[model samples]
Target: MDSAASEKSIIALDGWLKSPAGIYVREWEQACLDELTANIFGYNAVQVGMPQIDALAANRMPNKWQAATRMSNLDELALAAGNKQIAVALDFAELPFASQSLDLVVMPHVLEFAAEPHQVLREVERVLIPEGQVIICGFNPASLWGVRQGVRRITRSPYLPVAGEFISMPRMKDWLKLLNLGVTRSHFGCYAPPCRSTHWLNRFAFMENAGKRWWPYLGAVYMVHAVKRVKGMTLIGPAWNKKSASASQGVPATNRK
Candidate 1:
C-alpha cells in the first residue's frame, strides 16, 4: 500500500482502538504487558507502533522510546510527551539503533499492519542484545474474532482494521524462531465474541474464564514474550569430571573382585 493509504489505515486503527471492542482488547493486552515486562531488567526499551497503548508502562528501563513509521503519527508524540518518553519516527525494517543495542522491544499490533513483517522482525532481532526480550501483541487468526473478520471481509467491512493481516501463533513463533528469538512465555485472552456493542461484549465476559480453561489457544488476542538466543552459548558450570574420576579410581573394580 501507498504511504497515504497506510497512514489512513493506521489512523483508522487508532479510532477503532477507542471503541468499546477495542477498549476490551486494550485492557487485556495492557494487563498482560504489565505482568510480562515488570521483571525484565533492561537499560533500553522501545515500543514500536500503536502508541495509544503504553506497552512499556511497567518496565523500569532507564531509557525508553515510543517509535512510529512517520512523524505524522501525532498520537505517539503526544503520548510520549505525557509519559516523558523519547519519541522516534523510523522505519521498522531499518531501525536507527545499532546491532545488539536494545535490551527490550515491544510491538503491539505492528507486524500485522507492517508492509514487510519478516524484515521488521529481522530488524528487531538485529537490534536486540543477546538474551534480550521482545514482547508482541497480535490477533489470533484461529479465534471467533478471526472467523468474524473473515466473514466480514466478504461484505467488505472487516471487523478489524482492513490493513491488518492477523498472524497465527504458530506462524508468529516460526518467524521468531528463524531469528533465534525463543518464545519464553505466552498468553491468550479476550475470549468474548466479536461484538461491536458494549452491552453484548459485557454479556460475554463470562466466556473469558471458560475459554481460558477449555479453549485457551482460541482467544481473540495473544501476547508473546520471546528472548534472543545466541548460537553456541552455554552457561559455565562447576567441573565435576575430575572429582568423579578420582573417586572412581579409589574404588575396587567389580570384575576383579
Candidate 2:
C-alpha cells in the first residue's frame, strides 16, 4: 500500500524470521546458498534483501556486499564485517549500479515480498553483466507451506507477511526468459511441514529425500539459478573480403607490374 505499511510488514517479517519455523527456513536456505554459490566464479557479488540470511558467506568472491530495503542498524552490517564491507540500503525496484557491473547477484526472498516483482527482476537484469549469474530463493507456492498460507488466507490472522504474492516456478521461469536470462538449474529444500515445534520438524526430517524424489518441485522453498545473455555480439578481426581486399592480397601485384 504505502511506504509506512510496507515498513510495518517488514518489521513483522523480521520478527517471524527469529521463530523456530523461520530458523528452519534459514538453515535450509543457508545450505542451499552455500552449495549453489561455492563454485560460482565472480568478482563483485551482491545479495539483495533478507538481512537475516548471510547470503554471501559461502561465496568466495572478493567483493561481497549485502543490499537491504531496511535494517535495524546501518552500521550493524559493517561492524559484523571484519573489513570494509557493509550493507547498502537499496530499493529492489531501483538499484544504483552501472549496467553490467555486477558479476553475480543473489536475491533471497525478494521478489515474492515486493510490490512489483517484475520491476525488481528487471533491475536485477540491468545490473548483472552478460552471462552473470543470479541466484533467487523463494517459497514454492505448491508446497505444504503454501497450503498453510492458503488456509490462512481464509482466516483473517495470517503469519509472516502472508499478504505477499508468492510466485510459482513456471511463472518465474517465464519472467527470466523474458529478461533474456537462461535457466541454469534449481534446488528444492525445506521439505518438512511448516511446524513451529523443533520436535515435529525433526520427526518429519525423513520427508526431505522423499519429497525430493517424489515431488521435487513441491518443496517448501526453491532456489533458481539463471545466467544473463546478450545477443548479436561477435569479435571482429580485420575485414577480409576477397572482392574488395587488395591490402592483404600479394602486396598489390598490379601496382608492382
Candidate 3:
C-alpha cells in the first residue's frame, strides 16, 4: 500500500473503533466467534486481537478458549482470566508464538488494519497445527461498505485514508493459497443497508432470512473458514519447483539465496 492509502486506513480504523461502526464490527466479530466455537471443537483455540470477546468466551466456555493480544498490559488480565496465551509483540505480522501450536485461530478484521496482511497470514499459518482452521472476518471491498468508502473518496472526506485497501473475498482466497490454506465455507451477512444502527440490522430476523438467501454477497461484512494444507501436497508442485529452480539457475547462488 502507498503512504496516502495507509494513512487513510489508519484514520478509518481509528474512527471506526471509536464510533458506532465499532459496535457493528464487534457484533459481526461476535457472530464469527460463535461460529468458530461451534465448528472448531478442541482443547486449544486461539483468538488473536479481540480480547473482549475472548474474555466473554472464556467465562462462558472456560475449557476451550484462550485470548492473545499484541498489547502488553492485557497480558496480566488475560492470565488472570486463565488465558496465559498473551503475545506481547507489537507487530502482529510476526507473532512471537511457536509453530503449529494452535488448533484454531480467529482473526477479527485484523487483516484490513495490518501493515502486511500476507505476513500476518503467514504467522497465522505458522502457529496453526496441520488441519487446524482459521476464521477471518473482514469488510468486503465490493459491498455496501465499499461503496460508502468510494463515496467518501469522491467527496474528499478526511474520514478515510488513501492507503486503506478493502480486500475482496476472492483476493483473500488467493492470499490463503499463498499460505497453503483452503477455504471450506464462506457466508456474507449484514445486508440491512449501511445505516448507523448496523448492529441492530443483523438482529432483525426478516433481514437475516432474506439477505442470506437472496442477496448473500451484497453484505457489508463476510466470514471465511479455511483449513491449513499440508506442505508439498499439491498435485503439480514437483514439476513446478523443478521449472522454477531451473529458471533461477542463471543467477548467482548467493544472489538467489
Candidate 1 ranges with C-alpha deviation above 4 Å: 2-4, 74-76, 236-257
Across 133-229, the per-residue lDDT of candidate 2 in tens digits comes to 9999888888888888888857655544664678898999999999999999988888888787888988999999999899898998898899998
Q: What tens digits encode model 1's per-residue C-alpha lDDT throughout 86-163?
A: 555556777778899999999999888776789889999999999999999999999999998888847776888877
List model 3 lDDT by residue over 166-236, tens digit each.
68999999999888899998878766555555455445537756877888888778888899999665554
Per lDDT, the best of the predicted structures is: 1
Off by over 4 Å in 3: 1-15, 55-84, 157-163, 197-205, 231-257
Q: What is the lDDT of residue 125 in candidate 2?
A: 97
- Judged by TM-score, which candidate is best? 1
What is the lDDT for 37 in model 1?
Answer: 89
CA lDDT of 203 in candidate 2? 94
Query: lDDT score, residue 216, model 3?
Result: 86
* TM-score, one value per model: 0.87, 0.85, 0.72
Per-candidate local distance difference test: 0.85, 0.80, 0.66
User: In what order do the candidates fall by TM-score, top score first?
Assistant: 1, 2, 3
Please rank every candidate by lDDT, starting with the best.
1, 2, 3
Model 3 scores a TM of 0.72
> Distance from true position, residue 243, model 2, in Å?
24
Off by over 4 Å in 2: 70-72, 79-84, 155-160, 234-257
